[model samples]
Target: MMYKNSILLGTIGGYRDRFHQFQKDRSLEERLEIAKTIPRTHGVEPVYPQDLGADGSGAAAVKASGLAVSAVNVNIKTEPKFRDGSFTSTDAGLRAETVQYIKTAMDLAADLGTDMITVCPLIDGWDYAFQADHQKQWGWTIEAFAAATAHRSDVKVSIEYKAYESRNHIVMPTMAKTLHLCDRVGAPNLGVTMDVGHALIAGECPAAELAIAHDAGRLFYVHFNDNDRGADWDMLPASVHLWQTLETLHYMRRIGYDGWVAYDVFTRTGDNVEAIASTFEIMEDLEKILDKLGQDTIESIIASGMPQQGYRDLVKGLL
Candidate 1:
């Protein structure tokens, strides 16, 4: 699975829907057709089970599009019942429902010929101190994930983490923290979705974190976007954090991360197609610069333990 320059780029239909919210709800096929217009994009990541019709027609529509299914993102955060939490909720019934939903998603993903399922328990956290029992909630969350993945070892379950969304503090908030949860779950299929913007907000160097996840054998997928290091703005790729995003992509090359490099952007006020094209254009430019740098030179820089001097010299040499 050597992704290299041929990284299977993808994007979300939800972003398209949100961008066209003032218009009308676009069907999965319509969104898939829109994505097909973008160059270099080979897939469309549709929301799971919800998008998959009861008669399997929705999955059939996606398959007919001839676009690959990147991964099925099981949404668990929007309902009123999940206002407090979902997997870690005190209500046993709600916990059971969440686990069951994940299992169904895994089965559907397998059916769709995709070997991955992305589960982000975004609602499993608190906005205030003492609002929820931390220790107990952690236990439930781990158990729920373990149960979900235990159903099928063939399908990988990647948990996307964020510092805060739907709450002041999210449970799996950082790369290290999410990796710790993966360890506790003790499931071989469990991994992390290295969303770069979230990593930046978590105060982590995205390249280093990518290396950590790859070394741990837990880097499943990557969500590409940019932000001002203050929020998960989901802006276009390499928009604000130019150097950091470049370093992150360089490390992706370094580790041979052969996974779907998704263009998870939010273009609320911009032309969706142009935004997607611009992202690809920027990626192409940055990748060309990286190609000029060459893998051997990058390896040499990493080999030198003094990263500060290596980076300084590399920049000066480029100039």
Candidate 2:
């Protein structure tokens, strides 16, 4: 596989949900140390401001850990000031601060020898209809993103769209909508960071999303996780959607995607180290099976438009 892997910082930090929370809260140094032990991984994906050290000491810590940076996850939602929204905030000052923060993150990414940053604007959405003017918010967001991306040509700034959670309906909530931002901003470096779990939450097929993004030349990055077809569980890859995982990997190869596949799993109560290692282990299993079956063979089945035997062949390959 040409694809490299990165451990999402949240995976090692600690996981929590409505019913459960992480047993222990480990420091960033401890998490990175654990990250260095995971084999075949390219690096760690840390969030800005929270996981990053703005004073330069944090970068030194990362360098000492002997792991490279896959990408900087820019967080614009946690601050109380951004509770209403970041990019789409009604306050012009807040919006401008958000843009400058993202720009700084891009500069940090370049300084760290990486060219990618993932932004999940969870707070930039409305909970109900007629709460805000959609047109105005959209324009504000596009202009904010345009300024951020225009800061540099080499750094790739991507939007990771989610269906719901922080709000009822998010501004950028799908691959197509994310592509819309890329189109509206008209920046070559702006793209989509397609999170498979989020795709499932939005009731979309991962393979199809990859094909669309690939066609757009905006498939900047990928985040790998699974869910039960409803919530954004962020469970281990292939834990619930076996075929979805296989199909997604197949399409990635078909689309010539060589970017990082982030292990965005939430260990909840499981061992963190085990979660990291097993994510790669599962990918190895699926990737090998795909190779054994052959991409051309699988494509032949899909091209024929015959479902029964095609699926049978896929399942039989596993046995």
Best-performing candidate as measured by TM-score: 2
Query: Local distance difference test, per candidate?
Result: 0.79, 0.87
Question: How many angstroms is residue 120 displaced in model 1 relative to the true structure, after the best TM-score fit?
Answer: 1.5
- lDDT (Cα, tens digit) per residue for candidate 1, span 247-303: 898888777777787766756765666677787777888887777767677778878
Model 1, residue 124: distance off in Å is: 0.8
Q: 269-288 in candidate 2: lDDT tens per residue?
A: 66978888998998998899
Q: Return the TM-score for each candidate structure.
A: 0.90, 0.97
Stretches of candidate 1 above 4 Å error?
1-24, 53-57, 303-313, 316-319
Best by lDDT: 2
Which stretches of model 2 miss by more than 4 angstroms? 18-20, 54-56
Record all residue pairs in model 2 with backbone atoms less than 3 Å apart, i.e. clashing. none
TM-score of predicted structure 1? 0.90
**Number of residue pairs clashing in candidate 2, backbone atoms closer than 3 angstroms, sequence gap of 3 or more or interchain:** 0
